[model samples]
Target: MSDVVYTTTHRVVVPFYVYAGLAFLVATGMLFTGAAEFSGHYFQPHILAITHTMALGWGTMIILGASHQLLPVLMEGELYSVKLAYLSYTFTGIGIALLVWAFYIFHMGWPAKCGALLINAGVIAFFVNVVMSIVKSKKENIQAIFMLTAAGWLAFTTLAGGLLICNFTENILPDGSLHYLSLHAHIGIVGWFLLLVMGVGSRLIPMFLISKYDSPKILWSIYGLINGGLITFIFIFLREAVSVLYMIPVLCVTGGIVLFGFFCRKAYRQRIRRQVDEEMKISLLAVVMMVLPLVFLIAVIVTLMTISADVHMVLAYGFTIFFGWLTAIILGMTFKTLPFIIWNRVYHARAGTGATPVPKELFSSRLFNIMAVCFIIGFISFVAGIVISNGIAMKVGALLLLLCAFLYNANVFKLLFHKDRML
Candidate 1:
């Protein structure tokens, strides 16, 4: 299949992009305000707020939006229900606002509960939409299956998150929140975000590079390893096994990551398009960004093996995954995807009639470059601050990130409100 998907509605898709851009801005601002929180435990109220904003508002929302558009393309069919997609956005947007507010205030009450419930409903709606779309198409692609499984995991993640919030007041979990927190976080991180990335990235990176590499068998194996590792983790957590056993799942997932890297490498080596652009380069760097989390995870593992697990090390791991890997990929892919979507919207009916602005004209490369610089500096500074327990570094990093967020939002709006101009 070609890399163009025009099935989803502009109204449905654009709001998600707008919301996610605003979310990144809000999340970075929150991190700036709460930079002091990084010096302490990772479970602080503000920290929780920032995490959800990054995860739900910025990352998951974009994925949901993009998937709605891409799913039909993957299956070579139209989306089963655009109305359900709209439903998802409404419920999810409300849930995220309510939940973020509740967490910031540390209010683990009805608002939080209701927020969680609403998010759960939203994810369920999305999953139903996905399943029906895929079923109706009656076509199976490993890439689409990856999306399907990720949706299922997303449902579980929201459900688990709700239970965790409920456990703040009620005694629902047998083990404490900390023990369950690892399981909950990993399910969303690896299962939902990472799995989806690997799947979608596998298809997109190669396609954009104009590579002839396509291996369904290897893709299936990678899928199994990731899911197998996650399922094993759930089982071990349920059994309350020793900490060392967690390594089993870790190793399995790590193996999958390695294979994915190799897959991307092969695609790059065999690419037909030799002149890679800045955006493609940034997306490629996300492959390296994945290592940031793996390094921190190993540190956490070694610490657990030798001494007590350092909370700061754990914080670094989570931040690297969200900000480092996920954010980099999103920033890069946003340019790649959003431009085309907007260009199509503007020029689909006017194609070949006259001179027209290409997709890249919808946004500013200069703005994106400045944003990338801020992301690099800010991400490094904040991570270093967490390591050395320095508040100033964290603040500077967050401040830069805030600037980065502004630039991102600026570029996003530029594209969203783009006008037709022939050169």
Candidate 2:
């Protein structure tokens, strides 16, 4: 069906799309101006700011908005509370801004602590809404489970983050915030982002590919392995174990990812649709992009077995996950998803009546293609720069990424402001 089962009000969902677009532009700008920071420690001020901008502002914000609109559809029920969704947005938006600014200025005072607390509160609001929605739904699926679990993890991540912020000045944390940074990052990445993406992508990918293949058993297995891996990692982290101890969870998560890849392959092979769109192709490429980080991560673990880990490997691993795989998937899927959300607002009632624009036509494909090219070149160059500590390549890459971000924002805003027209 063209319409979502219970479509959220445009007022509720559109703001997120707009905010995410602006945040992406702002993040790229920071990336360009702060290109030098890429050579330094990941724990530095500007690096943290840019990371949060992409993570909370661009990534989490978009996911939150999409989830609010989609959960009801996936559950075949209504959202638990629109008010809660808006509350999550308000607190998250202001909190991200405060946090980003504080990080940029290297401020570890009230603004930082308050920002962290606000973000934690926002995650709580989201977690409550999601759990209640799942509980209320009569027919529950693995997707719902994945989402609810991810929400819980997000709450934990933010709570840890807040404590990390507090630890900066209070100095109450056991091993200093730096020691727990890996734990914080992994909790957010593996537990929250990866699981949530798998959940949403499993449903969306098959649907878009026109693959009739469905396997609850395989999905449940993926869920088990991924979460199992995450739990093991957290345990190892808390125990302060190093070397081969880390490998256990790493292998488990890797095994889970391998299963996921196999599942996607099966879906693709079983697909009834012969022709995939450009957007779908990019999304598929993103699925392939997942492999890069796995390789880098293995390298990082091996390096850790030695006296010191290679900083370049650590940075590239992170960059690959966030900017490479995650960004690719989001970039591809935004057009695929957002156009439909916007199209429903404009043409839901008139869909069967006359010549209404298809979701694909609401946004410019040319802009998307050009942006993809920029992303490809810039991503490779930026990674190569970081590996070799080449300032010139890094700056050039950032500049291209900034241009790509501009085109992306332009296309997104174009859809947001799309005028109602009858052809």
Pairs that collide in candidate 1 are: none
Instruction: Give all TM-scores, in the order shown.
Output: 0.97, 0.97
Tens-digit lDDT track of model 1 for 369-409: 99999999999999999999999999999999999999999
What local distance difference test score does each model get? 0.91, 0.88
Clashes of each: 0, 0
CA-only RMSD, every prediction? 1.6, 1.6
Q: What stretches of model 1 exceed 4 Å from their correct place?
A: 1-6
Error of 2 at 352 (Å): 1.0
Give the Cα error of residue 197 in candidate 2, in Å. Answer: 0.3
- Residues 1-423, candidate 2: write the lDDT tens digits: 335366678788888888888888898899999999899878889888988998899889989988888888888888898999898999989899999999999999988988998888888988999989888988778998999999999999999999999999999887789899989999999988889988998999899899998889888988998999999999988888877788889888888788788888888999999898888888888888888988888888898888777888888888888778888888888999899988989898888876898889999999999999998899899999999999999899899889988999989988988988889
